[model samples]
Target: MKYNNYYFKLKSYARNYNINPQTKKYYNLDFAYLVELSKLDMYIRKIILELSLDVEHYLKVRLLNDLSDNSKEDGYNIVGLFLQYHRNAGADIQSKADKYSFCSDLAEKHLDEYKEPKKLAVWNIVELLSFGNFMELYELYYQTYPSFNYSDYLKSIKFIRNAAAHNNCILSTLRKPNSLKKFSKTKKLANILGKIPEFRELENRDAMMRNPVIHDFVTLLFVYNDVMKVSATKNVRNKKMEEIRHLFCDEDGRIRKNKIYFEKNPYIKESYSFICSIIKYIDKKNKNPKHTNFLQ
Candidate 1:
C-alpha cells in the first residue's frame, strides 16, 4: 500500500507510534515497525481465533446435551421455547426475520427436505446457527437452565472473535486505555488472576485489565479454563490447551518469534508479559495434581 493510504489507516495510531509525545513533533514512522506490529496482531488474532473456536464448540455441545437431558426429549421443543422467549421479549422484528432467513437457507443447504425451525433437532439447530445466533440461544439457555453464569463473559469473547474473524488490527491501540463508557470487570476472572503470583498486586491487575484488548483476551482464557473443567471432551480440551500454552509460553513459541520488534513499545512488552504470566500460571495449575479440578 502507498504511504498516504497507510497513514490514513494509521491516523488514530500516529500519536503513539509516529509522533514524539514530549516534543509534540511528527516523525517518519519506521515501515518495519508497522510490519512487525501487523505480524504481532496476526499472531495474537490466530491464537484468539483458535481458543475462541474451542470455547464456542464446547459451549454448544454442553448446552445441547444439557438441554436435551433436562427437556427429556429430542430437544426440538426448546427451539420453540427459545424463539418464543425472544418473541415475547419484543426482539427486533428485523433481527428475527434475518434469523429466519438464515435458518431457511441452512435447511435448504443441509436437509434433504424442508423442515420447519420448530421441527429441527437441537443438534441440527445448534450446528446450523451462526456464532452470534448461538450466543443468543446460549444466553437464553443459561438463564433457563442450571449452568455457570458466564453469559456476560460471552460478550467479550464475541467481540474478540469477530475482530479475529474479520482480520482486524488488535495491537494498534495497545497504548490506549479502555475507553469504553461502561465496562464491568468479571469478578471471577479477577479472583482467579489474583491468585497468580504475578497479578497478586491490585495495581498490576488493574493496569492489565484497564486495556480493552488485554481484558477481552484474559476473559477468553478465563472462560476457556472454566468451560474445560466440565467439558465432555476432556482429551480435546487438554490437547487444545496444550497447543495454546506452547504457542504463548514455550521457548519456541510465536511470542518469542520476531521478539525484537516488541522491545521499543513498553505497552506491548508489558502486555505480552502479562499474558504469558497467565498462561504459565494455567500450565502450572494443570500439572499440579492438587489442582486437578482447575482446568481438567
Candidate 2:
C-alpha cells in the first residue's frame, strides 16, 4: 500500500497503457521461457481486471439504491447500522478506526450536521469496510430483497479480485462445500451448457466448478443479472461474448488471433471461451424469468 514515488509513477504509466508493470519490468530475453509465460499471465490478469470492475461497480450502485430505499422507508442510520454490525460481529473497532475514517473525514469537511453519519457514496463507504464487513452489509441488504442470494457471488468475487489485484495465480483448485449435493450432471449447469454449443467441449460440470476462470465468470454473470438493468446486462453480455470470441478462430478453432507460435496460449483462449459461453447462456436465459437459475 505504501508505494515509493517511483513505483507510483510506474504504476500510473502501467494503468494508462493497461499493462502490469511487473509483467514488463521482470521480463528479459535471457529468461525467454519466463517471458513467454508472463505474456499469458498478463492477458489473464487483464481479463480479470475488466470483469471485476464491472461487477464491483454494478454491485455498489445497486446496494446504494437499496440503502436509499432503507433510508426513505425507516429513516435508517445506514452508516450507524454498518458500524454497529461490525462491532457486534467482533471486528476490532478501535484498532481499525483509522481505516473507516472516511465517514468522519467527510462529515467534518462537507456536512453541515457534522455529528450525523456522513452521507458517503456507496462506493466510498464500501472502501472503508473490510471484506468481511462488506459481506455483512450486503447480507443485511439481501434480507430485504430476497430474490437472489448474492452472498455466494460476493464471496467468490472477493477471492478472484484479491488474487487478480495482487498478481497472484488464480488457477488454484476451488474449494466447494462438502455438504453441497453432488450431481452426476447438475440440472442448472446442464441447462446452461445446452445453449452454448461452443463450450460443450467442457464435458464435465465438476471440472468447470474447479476451473477459476469459468467459475468466476459464471458468478459475475449471476450477480450482474441481479443488479444491472436487464437490457444493459444483455448488451454487456454480448460485448463480453464478442471479446471472448475474438481470442480464437471460428472455423479453424485456433487459439489466439495473432497466430504467432511463440506468443500463443491455447489454455487462455479455452478458458475465455468456456466462460463466454456461460455468459451467452445467461443472456439468453434472462429473457425468460422462469428459466433463470440463480445457481447458488
Each candidate: RMSD: 4.6, 9.6
TM-score of every candidate = 0.78, 0.57
Using lDDT as the measure, the top candidate is 1
* Model 2 per-residue lDDT tens digits across residues 40-80: 45566666677777767666666776656654534234555
State each model's CA lDDT, in order.
0.68, 0.51
lDDT of 1: 0.68
Query: Across residues 1-296, which tens digit of lDDT does each residue of candidate 1 receive?
Result: 56423655445444345466888765545666666666667778888998899889888877866776684545766666766665532233223434666455555544333322335556766765677777887887667665665677888899889888997778777776445556666666666666766678645667778677788998898778767765366556667778877777777977677677656766667877888887777766665656644321
The residue pairs in collision within model 1 are none
lDDT of 2 at 282: 58
What residue runs in model 1 are displaced by over 4 Å at the alpha carbon? 1-18, 21-23, 26-29, 71-74, 87-105, 109-116, 177-179, 195-198, 229-236, 292-296
